[model samples]
Target: MKTTLVLAMTADGKIADVTKSPPTFGSDRDYAHMVEQILLADVVLVGSGTLLDGNESSEVREPDRALIQARIDRGQTPQPPQIICSRSGKIDPQLPFFSQPIERWLLTTKKGSLDWIERASFGRVLVCETADGSDIDWQAVKVKLAELGVENICFLGGSELAASLFAADFIDELWLTICPFIYGGSAAPSPVSGVGFTSDLAPRLRLLSVDRVEQELFLHYQVEKKSEDIPPT
Candidate 1:
């Protein structure tokens, strides 16, 4: 499976503002570019906190009918499933993300709580776990996605999920849009957060391309994963 992480950050590498507002730095053009990538994906994976961030769902924009039809022509679903991952499964049922027409799936650990979710008929529940702890078994998740014919996945989650996926070396490509503003604060989150990597195990990026539109700069990189970077199967 090919996993890509897409996000926009401030000039100082802050994904959120000091007030922790939903990222509004990117321009409409950046959003249109993101939607186009989402249209090409087989599934969209996001964190539960991101889903409840008071914004509308990540469902593809209706204005892009031709893009949807392009996917259909390639034998892909018109609307891909949006998978939300939570270690504790504490998503609020009233969030607007759940009311969208696209399929919604919850990926969580076995010990996570999901009473409200199951009863709500939101979508399928995929419990991904490792024996060591409640952390997601990413390898298993990849296998399952493959089983479901998911060849390309777009990740639009928060920093923690981004860190987890990057740490596991599951992410293949990264698309980042750097806005002109600077939101410098300790509380502001970056593109990757959580227990970070040491020098030896850090993932290296091979820059593929760079594009600048006005003040925002878009960078595309391919993650170079060494043999040891991949966890043993």
Candidate 2:
């Protein structure tokens, strides 16, 4: 599946403030842009941190008539399913996310899926782990997503998840909205957070387009991948 990492970061490259509070910096235009991207996706992917911190439903709120009609014409459900990635699967069942109208799915490890399996909170619970059992095997994840008919995925992240996908070379594109503010603390988190990559091994990108609206700048990039890195059909 083609995966796009969509994020809004501050001018100083922080997605969140030092306290890691919910993001409220993106402009109205940025929000519209996000909705547009989400509409193009077959499913939306998010890290558990985003669900816990944002405390918001993944549904497209207040979609315009045209957007709603477009999905109907495409024979897609009005709302896309949201698949949350959590290695621990320890989210509180009472979060507003559970009550949302959209279909909910969970991607976790064997041990992590036990509680969710019993609670029956998620419509589908997928257990995929690495050989060492340290993290999700993203290579396997790609195959599973394809098997489930997920052609396009919109990844709304909370840093760590973005880092993992990028490191694994599974991210195909990026839509980054650079906000006007600057949250310049060391504790502040950027779009991709984890152990930093070395220059030689870092993923490369080709600039696709840029749009400036007021103080915010929307940038699009295509991630360059080696032929060998791409998985076979």
Candidate 3:
């Protein structure tokens, strides 16, 4: 399976403001670009924080005709399912995300899945706990996604989830839109958060492309994987 992380950050590398609100700084062009990326994926994977932060829904509620036709031509669902990753499975049932038209799935630990087992909120509940039982095992999650025939994943994140996937070396590509503003607070979140990597252990990237649209710069990068990092079958 291929996973692509898509984010729009400030020039100073902040994905959100200090308040951690849903980013509204990106241009309309940037949003279109993000939707394009999402349309290419078989499913959209997002952290619980991102989903709950702004009461967001992953459904493409008003997709353009061209966008719908593109998916149909590719033999894909008009809108991909969204898989929410939450270690605690503590999502609020009242959140508007549960009422969206799109199919919903949950990626969480075994204990976390218990509350959702009898709920109709999610179409599928995947349990893949780490050895310590502290978090979702992303590697195992990857395998499960593969078994479910998820060949392409669009990861819409809130830093921590991005960090986990990067640490696991599961991210295959990145699409970053650098907005014109500079949000420089330490509390502001970046494209990747959590215990960050040192220079030696950092994942390398090969520049794929760059596009300038108005004041924003859209950057695409392919994550260079080491030989030993090949994913398990």
Error of 2 at 137 (Å): 0.7
Task: Give the per-residue Cα lDDT of candidate 1 at 35.
Answer: 89
Off by over 4 Å in 2: 227-233
> Model 1: what TM-score?
0.93
Between candidates 1 and 2, the TM-score winner: 2
Candidate no. 2 TM-score: 0.94
For model 1, residues 42-107, the per-residue Cα lDDT tens digits are: 999998778777445578767988999999999988988888888888877777776777887788
Clashes of 1: 0
Pairs that collide, model 3: none
Per-residue lDDT over 205-224 for candidate 3, one digit per residue giving the tens place of the 0 to 100 score? 87889999989999999998
Misplaced by over 4 Å in model 1 are: 113-120, 228-233
Ranking by lDDT: 3, 2, 1
lDDT of each: 0.84, 0.88, 0.88
Candidate 3 TM-score over all chains jointly = 0.94
Instruction: Check candidate 2 and list the clashing pairs.
Output: none
List the lowest-lDDT window of 10 residues for candidate 3: 224-233
Over 3-75, each residue of candidate 2 has an lDDT whose tens digit, in order, gives 9988899999998899988889999899888988988899999999999997765578765658867987998
